[model samples]
Target: MIAKLQIQLNTALYLRDPQSTDLGQKIVQEGIYMIDEIGFESFTFKKLSKRINSTEASIYRYFENKHRLLVYLIAWYWNYVEYKITFETHNISNAEEKLKIAIQLITSKLADDDNFPGISESVLQRIVISESDKTYLTKNVDQINREGLFKGYKSLCMTIASYMLEINPAFKFSRSLTSTCLEAAHQQIFFAEHLPRLTDIKKEEKMYDRNCEFLTSLIFSSLKS
Candidate 1:
C-alpha cells in the first residue's frame, strides 16, 4: 500500500506542470542527483547541466547559483511534506491523533520507495542542520520569521504547537520545541543512514518508526508534565 501511494505521489509531482513546462525542474532534479552522488562541495552546475541534457545558461535561467538551487530544493521538500500532512490529517479533532498522524506522514514519506531517489543521506543532513545558518547568511537576517521557506517551516511548527496547546493548555514550552522535534527526527534519520554501525538498528523502517515513536512520546509527555 505504501509503495503504491509513493508511486502515485511521484507521478503526480512529475505531471504537475504539463503546460509551459519549465525546464528548470529537470535541472534541479539533476542537481539534486549530483549532490547525492557527490558532496555539495564537489557539485557544480556544469556537471548538473551535463547530467540534465542542458547548458549552463539554461540552468542559470532557473537558478542564480548552485546555492540558491540547493535552498530551493530543500524548500521544495518541506513544502511537499507540509502539503501531504495538511491533506491527510487536517480534519482530525484530537491533537494527539494529529501529532501521531504528522509523525507517521513524515516517516512514511521519507521511507517511501518513490522518494527523491538521488538525494543522499549526507545532503539531507546538511540541509536540516544548516537551515538556519544558510537562511541567515543568504538573507542577511538575524532570524527567519517572516516570509519564504523559513516562514513556511515556522507556520507548520506553530500549527503543531497550537494543536498541542489545545490538548494541554498548561504545556509551557514555546513553538520552538516543535522545531526542535523536527530537527531531532532529521538527525535520527541521518544517523540511521550514515552511521548505522553506531546505531543498534540496521533497518531504515525500524529506525524511522522508532524516531516517530520517540517524537510522539516527547510531545505527549510534555503535555502531561
Candidate 2:
C-alpha cells in the first residue's frame, strides 16, 4: 500500500537522480550490495563500475564522488524511515503508543520492503548502521550541512522528538534523546554481532529485539525522570 510514496531529497546530494533511469538505477542497486560486501573505505567507483559494467565516467555523471553517493543512499534511508514512521503511527492517538511503535521500527532488524522494487532495505539498513556516520564525520560536514544534505536525518530526528514532547512536554532533552536512541540502536546491534563483549545483549537470531528493549527502556525511563 505504501509503494507510491515519493521521497524528496536535497538536490545537492547528486549530480543526477539515480532513480531516474535504468543505468542510474543499476548503479544504486549494485552499489548497495558492493558497499555492503566491501567496507566503505574500500568501495571505489572503479570497483562499482566494474561490477555494474558501466564506465567510471558514466558513473561520475550521476555523482561527483563516492562520498556523495554514500550521502545519497543515507539520505534515502532516512527519508524512507520517516515515511514509515508517518504511515505506521498516523492512526494511533496515544503519544506513548506512537513513540513505542517508532522505537520498534528504528531499533528492530529491517526486512526487504516489497514496495521498493529494486532496493533492499534489509541490506540498506546495514549500511546505515555501519557507514552512516561517514557521511558527516568528515571536516567538510559544516559545508555539507549548509548544503542541506543532512536534512533527511535532521527531519527524522525532529519527528521522533515531537513524539517525545507529546509524552512529556517538560523534557528538555527530546532532541538529544531522540538522536541518542537512533545511534544507540545501531551501535548496540553492531556490537552484538561483531564485538559481543562491548554490549550486554547476546548475539542471536532475535538480537534486534534485545536492542529494541534496551532503547525503549532507556528512552522511556529518561523521559519519566
Candidate 3:
C-alpha cells in the first residue's frame, strides 16, 4: 500500500494550516483546481468560496490573500518535490545515478497519486510550471523571503547541489547550476507548450522524455567542464 504523505509548509505562508481541518483541506484542494482552471490573476476568494460553498471570510481565515495562498501552494510543491528527491535517492550509493534521478524527477510529468488525496499533483504541477514565478516576483519578495517562505525551494536546490558536488568535488557553481537548471526545466516546458519557437522540443515528441534528456545532458556537461 502507498503511504500517505503530508507536506509541511512555512507558517508565514498561510494564516491557518490548510491541512489541519476538513474545511481547510477543502480550501487547498479546491483552491488548486480553481487556480489551475482560472489562473492566479483571475482567482479570487469569492470564486473559491463559491466553489467550496463557503464564504470569502472563511477562506481568508486560512490565507491572508490570494498572493499568500499562491506562495503557500508553490511552497508546498517545492517541499513535496524535495521529499521525493530525498526518498528516491536515499539508497543510491552512486552520485551520478542519484543526480540523474533528481533531474528526471524535476523534468518529468506529474500525475495524481492516491497517497495525496486532496491535492492533485498533476494539476498542481501545471500551476508550478506556469504561475510559480508570480509568487516571488513582487516587490515585497524580500519581506516574505525574510519570513523563511522560500525555504522549501532553497532546500530543494541545496539537495540537488549536494548531488552535483558529490559527482564533481571541485565544481564551484553547484548551487548556481542547480537553480539555473531548475528554472530552465520549467521554462523549457512552458515554452514547448505556449511559445514553441522559444524551445527546441517538438510538439510531436514526448515532452517529458525530451526535457529529461536535455537537462541530463546539460547538467553532466557542465559538471564535466
Model 1 clashing residue pairs (backbone) = none
TM-score of each candidate structure, all chains considered together: 0.74, 0.96, 0.97
Runs in model 2 deviating more than 4 A are: 1-5
List, residue by residue over 32-141, the lDDT tens digit for candidate 1.
Answer: 56776686678788988888787988777666667656555555556556776787776788877887787776554253224444334345544554342354465534
Off by over 4 Å in 3: none
Off by over 4 Å in 1: 1-22, 109-147, 195-205
Candidate 3 residue lDDT tens string, 115-168: 889899999999998999998899999999999999999999999999999999
Query: Model 3 misses residue 75 by how many Å?
Result: 0.8
Q: Sort the candidates on lDDT, descending order.
A: 3, 2, 1
List clashing residue pairs in candidate 3: none
Give model 3's TM-score versus the native structure: 0.97
By the lDDT metric, which is better: model 1 or model 3? 3
Query: Which 10 consecutive residues of model 2 have the lowest summed lDDT?
Result: 1-10
What is the descending TM-score order?
Answer: 3, 2, 1
Q: In model 2, what lDDT does residue 37 have? A: 97
Please give the range of 10 consecutive residues that has the lowest summed lDDT in model 3: 200-209
**lDDT per residue as tens, model 2, 86-181:** 999999989999999999999878888878877889999999889988999999999999999999999999999999999999999999999998
